[model samples]
Target: MSGIFKKIESLVEKGKEAHAKTWHNWAGNIVLEPELIFHPKSLNDLQEIVKKAKKHGKKIRCVSEGHSWSTLSVTKDYLVIVRDMHQIQVEKSEKYGWTITAEAGATIKQMDDKLRQHKPPLSFDSMTVLSSVRASGIVATGSHGAKCAGASISDQVVKLQIVTGDGELHVFSDENDPKEMSAARINLGLLGIMYKITWHVQPLFKLRMIDFQPPIKSWLYPATLKEFVEKSDSVEVFYWPFNESELDRNDDKLWVKQWLRTDDPITTSQAELGMERVCEDLETRFGDKLYQFIVKCPESTPYITNLLWKAGPVSKPQNVVIPAPDAIHYQSGIDNILCDDLEFTFKADKDFANVAEEFNHIVDSVYAYAKKGKFPMNLAAEMRILKASPSLLASGYDEDPNAIYCFIEVLAIRHTSGFEEFSAELATRWMKKYKARPHWAKAWEHVPGIKPYLREILGKRLETFESVRVKYDADKIFFDNKSLEEVFYGSPKSTFTESHL
Candidate 1:
């Protein structure tokens, strides 16, 4: 062991300090070897980690599952893993109704299971499709579901607790400070290491998911798209691009997944969605080999994608009614298929004119690039409609009560050649055309001049976030990454020594 490793081991208890091993994100894209890594278990342990980092003049960053594609969790000095703070408490208040207070490290699946077993049963209003992620991590990164009436996951946060860089525990709630709550809701880990988060939940509900295939020309029209979104409680669209010759029909089709609130009894044995499909078996058996081939050949992507689509759930129309948790998290084992993803969220007009126009533009652009012998995207292009969020830094944030947000993303298998250039070009186009904001947790750092663009586009919100951020972390311990500094402060700067503790 090196001198640094020996010193780090001496600082923490035996099992708490991780050996100086390199850490990588789920997609294996970003890798870092911090000077020291600690898995603190309790609130006191979190505070102690912060205090020690301050004493050693080392910067600190917290991570949970490392699902983010961005460098927000990067820290060369100290990396704190909060996963051991797993605790769950569900309570009902006369004023607050149903609320669940979960520790930062608790997984969404854990919360869902506990809520399902609750006396009355409860669940989140909106959530991401993957239940394996940490609840607080998803909330901090502004993850969202397809609920047209529901906002991003952060909007469900009613109270938050964190240990700031000063080694002091602070709590923010609407009852105490709404402004701070807004900033803390989707903090991007700049403020501090969050230890506990409380969210307002709802009684469990059932939903019927109707999957169908419709011709692209008719289904994606602005007016028609608006009708489907408005009619369903949640709508998700997936398009796997293909060359005209590969399709059996003249025009390609879209797979539309619509979820509606249902009073019908729930399916007693709800199998994981898409698990029973034959395509899933093929994917599990040959996904890696196929992905490797696509990465090497690149040109074979279209044909393989088309075949996968035919064998996928969309190939046949079907309907199933399941409880809210199952419906919200429809798919499983997605993280197993590593990929590079970039998502954008922008305001949509009531008629969805902009949504229709931009989505079609993207579809056309994909084929256009392929014709030029460039395959930047080979996987599904997904879109979801959601209501506005109150979190200041959230991509879906807006003041209008009726405001709607269009969430769309382009994905390519990880390490694909020309993918970065392709995604950057398309991202730039979307930014210029619709003032689209990229999801903070996804890939956007590579986009040309992303920092300045975000600074300019998110002017007032950035200013508000900076103000609240300094109150908790005046020394900038958590603000330790280049990407965040460039976007938030316009450039990299040194940390101030004044302590709030």
Candidate 2:
């Protein structure tokens, strides 16, 4: 045997986590079988896998939960599952405050379970609704909470331990290595596999979640939306697009959800968390029959949308007060139906910004789609408020670091035929009209003009990220496939088909 082959073979045995397997993400939307899927149990185990992959001229991708809709985690050669590396060490300080250093594979749920056990307890300013997502996955992809007081999940990170393509473990922090830290904060799994994530946490606090179905006039008027967000700890609004025609209401209506820091204390559990009962009522009580009927002929989108609001438990107004974790999350309930989601962010510093304008246009398209016999969207469009971010890759581009931004999510239900094409049209318009950017984890990478839009908005920050990327993984050994290539390299193949636009 050749000397090089013998050396590579020896290194392969050192990577005990390696194995062959067929795998699918949690949502079952994406599936892939890698030649070898490695579940590293420790930092050393992870380093060994990287060393072997680099030696053998193989590519690697790290995945946890695989919640992202994009093909970012898809790879044929090597897949590294870091969940087994779960571990954590926490520290409290009089000067720096509470800091928790958790292995990348650890989950938000796990962190909350442990941190809340502290004498004073601790929690993140915001967190994704799905607690099962890994800390590494969410932070690396820039997952966010609905709170405007906090930045993307990545922004909470104070330090990171990463195993780069060359199998070296490097720790970078915002204070000491701002440039490197900026890139590592939202590393995109390109620099390397994250081994440990350290975050700054706040003292455990109580929050109240209130549900309001305000009249359409309230949401349509920019003044109301601004007040709702400015007064609440966090605010989210859901607009039922076909409401005017479907519900037979005088004007459109929105499910306005607001969360506020409360002295009310944690005093809720079971049969009353409210969300479970709400989803149940949605399926059984108020509008189940109507919703099911509309499902058969989604062309009657107005009916389905009406059924959604009617079925919801918040007929008048409802309130729930719970622990910080429970209050921050809800069932995202994204999977029950096959669908595609597209998200865009507008500046909206003090008010709706360009959103008020672009929103009107999209509403027009909703009517056009329905008029052309296109399926009407069955789910509510989600609106979230994001404060200015320190993470360079945050959708806002960090231009106005202190400015507030609003994230709007448009859901395209699969039950309705040709929703993907319609979504593509909406996403395309967002980038061109608002000069918006998509949340990294969702399905917006395919939108046309994405790279150019990001390039123009990000400016020097993009170049800095690219330079730091090259510094960490000079060979791009972690480059998994064409999907990753399209993002980092800006290749033409990574974009959506023009026809979809």
Candidate 3:
């Protein structure tokens, strides 16, 4: 499309990955064809690409593992795949304590494997359920685990190296500049292309994972759920509609998973864990086949979900002590089944009175809609309890570290009828009732009135992020996506100026 591609090709070891081939996201929901794509090997390669792009007035966007469900990583200009920059190192610093430093492209699994193999073993304070995502991308989207005392993954970032739109490398850390660090913690790739990252880690610990199916009416309330969360290091709740009874419409049971840090010896050895994974992989394959059939017959979702629950492990009870990493990443093989997810996070007060009501409302809404012959939600409604984060734009942002927050999401198989409308309805209600904020990396672009609502609620915080963003990329070279532009710049249209190289 332009001669600048020739100039940029001379700067990198590999000319380009693709010229104009179509690219799709992990879910195949968003697709685009960039004029040029590159997998730079080192910092110099990234710097050279950035400089050439800036000179040619082309925008740049870095993609991680392509797991994002939103358009945050979408760009038709210059796309960068950071897989080549994966290099991880474990460093012990007096000021920052023990940290795992790695290039921005390092996947969570790579880091987890390295930490587990260390002399004394090491692990992050919090981790996402999936380990295939890149570290930098995880932090940018504020992904998190269910640890009650732990915040989002972004909170664990101690240092970062980025190449700004000016084509200069800059390093920022909490020790040097907390204000700037706040912005860099979860900048959504607007500030620059992250080159490397340093994450806080701790001595590897064990967790006793226990699962129980309690009656929904008994432990699903605010007070009891509060006790459950307060007593556990990490807690997650899942409810599959029609799990208990389809005809009676009595989904009276809830599958609750809790993890508590313990001194107990590891009950599952590395070999055993590997074996378990193999078995689970087989199960996932079988489940995927069933899902394919259900996808063809969408109306059988409720019946199939009920059958799966009755036959699944959640129908029984189990407990085991395992390494923290193993427990944190509980399930795997999700890439086979594509789903649409909409997630939101809101602060829970000391007693969690409001959060409890809001959660109950979610369940009630599902049933209410179902009664009218609408089955917008067939998958599990998942919720996690996490501590607050200090990142300015994080969904769970709060001043107090001890503050409890609830991150809830509803998922549906891709192409499920009425999913978009259902999500929009819930998003609007949550925003108005609980002042909830949607997860940056999940589905939210189609939600009506979302842009104005975010602007109104995140007025000052958006300004703070914008101030720092301008300092790094004054010309807005990284602000090419319409979804992010709608939130920060109050524009729902692309401002990219096309120029032939």
Q: Highest TM-score among the candidates is held by which one?
A: 3
lDDT of 2 by residue, 1-501 (tens): 699998997676646545556877764667998888888888888888888888888889989877777777888888888888779877986755998889988977788888888877888878987777888999888888899676788988888999996799988886778989988888788889999998888898888889877666446566766667778998777776666465434466677778889988566774566666466435543343454456677766776675555645345465778777877865534434445577777677366656555555556666677777776566657878878777778775565677877788877553446666667677777665566778878876666556645555666777788898888888888877675554555642434335434
Which digits, one per residue and each the tens of the lDDT, describe model 1 over residues 208-234? 988988888767898899888989999
Against the true structure, candidate 3 reaches a TM-score of 0.93
Q: Could you give the candidate ranking by TM-score, starting with the highest?
A: 3, 1, 2
What lDDT does model 2 reach? 0.74
- What TM-score would each prediction reach against the true structure? 0.93, 0.87, 0.93
What TM-score does prediction 2 earn?
0.87
RMSD of each: 5.6, 4.1, 5.1
CA shift of 352, model 2, Å = 2.4
Lowest lDDT sum, 10 consecutive residues, model 3, at 492-501
lDDT of every predicted structure (CA atoms) = 0.83, 0.74, 0.82
Cα displacement (Å) at residue 317, model 1: 2.9
RMSD of 2: 4.1
**Candidate 3 lDDT, tens digit per residue, 277-307?**
7776777677767766666776677688788
